[model samples]
Target: MSSATAPHRVSDAPSLVVSLENSPEAAAAARDVAGDFLKGLGPPPGRDASDAVVLIVSELVTNAVRHSRTRACTLSLAAGPGTVTVSVADASPRPPCERNPDVRGAGGGFGWPMVRRLAVSTSVETSSQGKTVSAVVAREGGPSV
Candidate 1:
């Protein structure tokens, strides 16, 4: 690939970033922000999509609290032309992992799967200081206003 033929990327997404204390109350607050962000999306006519966004918020926040030992975490929301992105960052150096289910198991190990189903794309990135889990979901055919 040459410079002249390189792909172009747009950098116009609107974003909100928040640093939250690592506590159960903070987690609940993060979910509320995420839910509000989703509700504030241009398409306001459908309640179902907003509900799905709330579900995503719950899973992501829960995972951060359960697996991380960070004193604080950051929640970021970015809105694009057709999609919304949610990212949660924690100070834990450990990457998020999924648990293998046992046939006899009836609980646990279901958060990641539920996130995958709700979001169009989900990813985890780790740095020397911490980790960030990001998920993107499309808001297609939603409210026009």
Candidate 2:
């Protein structure tokens, strides 16, 4: 039972936190944790919001694993009425950049933009030790494609 496999659920708050190793597998693990939390939210927000939130979680965790210079990272999810806030924290203060997309899709400059487009709001907080990227996604309709 490691941090990666067992996520920490906050009893006082509508949120969940998961510790992750900075590897490709981090994204999958994050999605699982996010899905579990979303499933408990009930009918109001419905499936679309949950799917979008999970995707956002996947993208953020993937970015941290791929770009951050750390052994591990943390994924946090906080749910609101019709929205969820997804945050990924790693031991790097550098914020993510939105790169030019590769039309041929050989290179990946897509995830960041897609994240921006999907979230109701997005932000990055940096500290001397690390940085956290957060996004708010709505349960119903979100950003325009």
Candidate 3:
């Protein structure tokens, strides 16, 4: 008898990693991935945190597209016991800076601050070829509120 192909059964919550091109499309794609990741979490303990995650994804991806020379980016989502970690890697050695208000007043930078405000933990690491900006958000308790 021929063996029947078993139907694929996926878990309700699963980690996702997506590589993106350094273009405008990457920002939108990252946001979509964030939304899907939160939905896969089966119900965010707090809705605001979920929204923040999406916005953070967009801002990070935009920065990657704008600054990176390699024109390649990656978005990764991992759910832990109480937090979800979102990491964006791009081919850029120059790290992001939190420009002062006077500099921002020139109307150029603010993304980093927004990211810092939304995430429980934010970090940037530089590698020989590029950098990775990672943010961890508390999915359970939700943004210290």
Candidate 4:
């Protein structure tokens, strides 16, 4: 887990960026990072919002590692007044697709769909070198769980 949080700038809110190897642990690391980042905020996002962010981060990072040929990926998180933006960049230019979920719960495609459901907005950008999948989640004012 190689990560860095951007220095607080007078004009912008704080942000976090992490570089992760294409391994099983990357998703967990990303979740922890997101949790910590949210907690550090002056007024942290609600429990629902925080959980949604972690779940979305895990899904995006997992997709990048499992589907792409890339050896590593980068995760970026930025929080504003009422929303947080999560972005994962990988070396593959192919866009993500939601696959049919497996009923047995052994292992099937479900990440993409869950992300869409939790996020207020989601987008993907692709170039010759790679692609970045981004999702924005609205922060609620409820108490943390």
Per-candidate local distance difference test: 0.68, 0.82, 0.76, 0.82
In angstroms, how far off is 53's CA in candidate 3? 0.5
Instruction: Give the poorly placed runs of model 1, Cα more than 4 Å off.
Output: 1-13, 101-107, 141-145
By TM-score: ranked, best first: 2, 4, 3, 1
Off by over 4 Å in 3: 1-13, 101-106
- Candidate 4 — which residues are off by over 4 angstroms? 1-13, 141-145
lDDT of 2: 0.82
Which 10 consecutive residues of model 3 have the lowest summed lDDT?
1-10
Predicted candidate 4 versus true structure: per-residue lDDT over 1-145, tens digit per residue: 3443222222233688777778877788878877888888878888889889988998898898799978888888999888889999999999998789998998767889888888888999999989999999988821121
Candidate scoring better on TM-score of 1 and 2: 2
Q: Which numbered prediction scores highest in TM-score against the true structure? A: 2
User: What pairs collide in candidate 3?
Assistant: none
Residue ranges of candidate 2 with Cα displaced over 4 Å: 1-13
Total backbone collisions for each predicted model = 1, 0, 0, 0
lDDT of 2 by residue, 1-145 (tens): 4455455554433777778887667788888888878777755455677778889999998899888968888898887877788999999999999889999979898999988888989999999989999999887757541
TM-score of each predicted structure versus truth = 0.76, 0.87, 0.82, 0.85
TM-score of 3: 0.82
| Error in Å for residue 104 of model 4 | 2.4
